[model samples]
Target: MAAGAPRVFVSHLSGVAVFDPNGDQVGRVRDLVAMLRVGQRPPRLLGLVVELSTRRRIFLPMTRVTGIESGQVITTGVLNVRRFEQRPTERLVFGELLDRRVTLTETGEEVSVLDLSVQHLPARRDWEIDRVFVRKGRTGSAFRRAKGETLTVEWSAVTGFSLEEQGQGAESLLATFEQLRPADLANVLHHLSPKRRAEVAAALDDDRLADVLEELPEDDQIEILGKLKEERAADVLEAMDPDDAADLLSELPEDDKERLLNLMQPSEAADVRRLMSYEEHTAGGLMTTEPIILRPDATVADALARVRSADLSPALAAQVYVCRPPDDTPTGKYLGTVHFQRLLRDPPYTLVSAIIDDDLQPLDPNATLQLIAGFFATYDMVAAPVVDETGSLLGAVTVDDVLDHMLPEDWRETEFHLDESDEADEDNEEVAAHDS
Candidate 1:
């Protein structure tokens, strides 16, 4: 522990209310961010991930933090609205380090890691681990059960919690990545050793693993998929979006792809196969077969309910396709689509066919990527339907799927950049301007 520094346990820091210099409540601290340092040096505290009124999680760098006491934090009164995005080297202290198992050097007994303490280094702007709070033993007497005793020990007294130890196959380690975005999780998985990556992949549920796989680079996707059992891999594939599944399957060897496809449900396999038949860069190739579709006679109320589903993406939810007869595809006759704006404007009992956007034209299955891009640019649509030669609605291509094909492979890292210091300065100026 650094000398003459106030000691604060991480548990006490979680959920602490943050206030500005004027003593106005800003938000609550959600998590502490830290950068893992090399060698015997303690990890450096980076900042705090704070949840504001809008439920947006944003970063508040330690540089702007003025005080930490009495279950409250005082800031420099500068607030940023943008959400926090984790950098490659950073880790969340509350999510990852707490509730883990560590070895006590003197006792050689494994104890449940309960909480962590960090201290500001003397005369320096750095915060480092000072002590570890651990549960010593099972607090129980035969029939009566109770909580264990807690002990705060020097940071040096614990073992098995270094950067290298993070990969030692503990299920507890995965808790850290749970709150991260799929893209961010994919980046963390990419940096892990092959064995550790497989362990983490196995630990994640099908839906989460599917989301992460879609965000990963193709080679990484294939490698992780290869690690799973054939049956489990198929299940994960089924959970993924049809377009992403087809794209990944298209990258595999024919035999491997066939074997996995054979394991999928007939309906899912059919959707993927339909997508695979088209050229990889064509509308047919990029479209998702499971788009929202409604019969022409369906009521706007019914359409609105389907749109309310949490599973639907913003782009897919923006509109619903109106077709004839069979609710499922091959939707008999391709009628015009109904945009969400129309759905809202009309009464609930109104038929969908009445408000269809006749101005929007559906794309042919054979349309090239360039043509599809132009169509989206010209129509300003988030998603456009794909129709077969007979005018049967096949699926819709979302703008996101198009960007997936168009952007460079490394575009994930380059898409957005936010600097903490710049955000703080902007907020300070905004506060100053408002006062004047």
Candidate 2:
């Protein structure tokens, strides 16, 4: 495992003794069950489980798990043992409420909780209860501790969470993209403050960061590029499509842009400069350099062999582009694409061109965005080839790029907006959407 990454399954819940705030041994933990948070799926803890005597199970919010030790489980507060004797209501365990959506009474508005605030109590510490709190969402809300309200119950009431929504002065931004579409992610980024935008950009893995960057508007892209460290910015630029990289570089001041270009690999720098040489908003300027090219005379077996040998980009699909002789056109004359699955289904000796779709639509180097959009809509293509006037293929434009242009400037705010009344409606909508 890499440094700072936790070792999975090294410690299990079985055989660990449970203790309350009073330091009384309640029972041994038999198992640990955790659910993903409201907006975070397959990541982020939601809740945990503790097994007690009499074969009863106790459910605890993730906030309640104060600490995990070699042989002990410490909770935030004391709980009545009787609470574990009965099964929890289905609503508490398997409904929208558990997802972190709740109604705020003050404005009759709904707010989706990112996480619950809980007090942590550790044994042998200087103070009885740890001042540092564990929370899923933004912490330090003065209204979190209203008089006479049970913290545990209030924490448990959470159901869903808002991303870019809650008018928090744009300080909160959704940075992760585990389950978000590129459009949704673009929306979330649009609402974040400059600092929060940097935080979000820093949190994303390279591929996702590249995806979101490719989707951002030119102005927003410039702002984000300015905030990132030189090294980090270089890394993101290296991971982006060549045309996108060139476009972003073109937006930078001459000095910074030249410095970044110097930092890139010679091949990458050359590709970006070539793309940038074209007029902005044209097909040649917008196309990606990493096209799946193969020899037209090659057999399916030979093509497959090349595919296996080459280091293909992870973002590419299963289709490979077959081109004419390099001597005829340095960039290789435009041919057609062949789907890997189709090639696999055919005889190995079959010629690549025989199996490829020769009638595939191609884009001219100077095609406008409106023309590109119309072509994409008409052909339903994930990508389209861009060829020079001499019929030599240069690059291709992907659907993801087109989708980036379709999102509105205020899209990010839509994700974070949460009102009390919308909580129930939004939860239902999310559930229905997920189910479908």
| Best candidate (score: TM-score) | 1
lDDT of 1 at 387: 92
The residue pairs in collision within model 1 are none
| Candidate 2 lDDT tens digits, 108-149 | 444433323222223322111111111233322212321222
In candidate 2 the C-alpha lDDT for residue 105 amounts to 34
Question: Residue 31 of candidate 2: its Cα lDDT?
Answer: 31
The global C-alpha lDDT for each of the candidates, from Candidate 1 onward, is 0.79, 0.56
What local lDDT score does residue 249 receive in model 1, on the 0 to 100 scale?
A: 95
Model 1, 307-374: lDDT tens digits are 99998889999999998877576578989899999899999999998889877679999999999999
Runs off by more than 4 Å, candidate 2: 1-193, 196-208, 215-220, 301-318, 325-330, 406-436
